[model samples]
Target: MLELNFATSMNDAMSDTMIKENPFSSQPTTSAFTEESTYQAVCKSAVASAIFAVLGLSAFLAQMFMLLPILGIVFALLALKAIRAYPDELVGKGAAKFGLLLSAVCLIGSGAMHSFIYATEVPEGYRRISFAELKPSSRGTDAQGFPKRAAELDGEKVFIKGYVRPPSGKQYGLKSFIMVGDFGDCCFGGDPAITDVVAIKIQSDDTVNYGYGLRRIGGTFRLNPSTAASDEEEIPRVFYEIEADHVR
Candidate 1:
């Protein structure tokens, strides 16, 4: 009789426990189902790193865009440090790693490609020079003469970049065209201003098509000796000219 009573009590206790745990009966279940995740919040920096890494692909466009990868690396490092400090609270280790990988690839690849292009850009036997070197001395010269640096380079083979000013006669099948130093001067039509223009006569049978932007020319640099002559009226309209061996 006592054993039967004990068995009945045990059955009642089991039923009570089940009733308390029934979710449909307005009772609490195990903490697993009801509790919110403790570490569900993602590390914000890690997200930012992933985003920046995607944008880092722009590095292929130009050398200046390498900044994107640099920023991605920085953000990724910060995210990893934060996650390490709060492992249980934050997530996104994968995002951080991805950011690191892509950023490194872009930074290194762009740097190498640009370096190669630069090393090979200027053809052999040609020295690169900008318009800055060809300008006349601001401190005043002998009758508005070009700087001494320009005189030294005269008759020497040189490489320079300048805009192809719109030709007055023909756009295509041009044997020669006037080149200007500044983009504004070429597009908006600035005066030739003696020091600002370079007359380019392509040496090869390759006649150039007129276009905008800087033209890369490698050839013999010429200084119109008439500019330095005693008579101001003897000065040529364009003070510099190039018998271009290469035009791009």
Candidate 2:
């Protein structure tokens, strides 16, 4: 009888312990979950706003090129969404508002710069010449087979109209330039037959949408006779050059 009593007591104790360990016995608590969500929202807003602000500044610096300002506007708008989501966070609210302001400044500055560069009359000494006027002797070849047409174009101002072909292979650089005519053979960095095509160097290091259709540009023309080669051999040649004081 004593042994049986002891056994029954042990079984009862075990059952009680199992009941306490059961997860369903306790009520669910969601305080942790709510806190985590709030923290994430605040962080997201702050980060997004900060990024937009930086992009806006970049746009301002490159406003002269018309590319940076446009990008800044886009990033600022995105930041605003994040800020609105986390209104409680001071950083998010500040950053979002700043980004919007920066974007606006970029747009206004870019427009003003464009007007200044393009609207001003070409200087008296700058003559409007054509591609046919370029001397054959001005063309020279570098070690990489890239032509040095600018040497022939020294001290001359010419205006040539052509399609803006983005640098292919290895020719694209930080500066803005384009190919004028369709060259018979497309070289690594340039098209040879379309000698009329020239690269226009923009004053600002701003990124722009170059994949769009052809644009017409006018500027004072000069050339530098130097060969720039990259690891890629088939880099197209950047010959025939124009310096557009303004691009339309």
Q: Assess the local accuracy of residue 60 in candidate 2 as a C-alpha lDDT between 0 and 100.
A: 36
lDDT of 1 by residue, 21-106 (tens): 66677644567554654536799999988888899998876666799999999999999999999897799999999998999899
Question: What tens digits encode model 2's per-residue C-alpha lDDT throughout 158-221?
Answer: 4454455544443434356554443322222453443454666665443324443334455656
Go through the candidates in order and give each one's C-alpha lDDT.
0.79, 0.52
Candidate 1 residues lying further than 4 Å off, grouped into runs, are 1-39, 131-145, 161-216, 222-243
Each candidate: RMSD: 8.2, 12.4
Q: Which candidate comes out best when scored by TM-score?
A: 1
Task: Choose the strongest candidate by lDDT.
Answer: 1
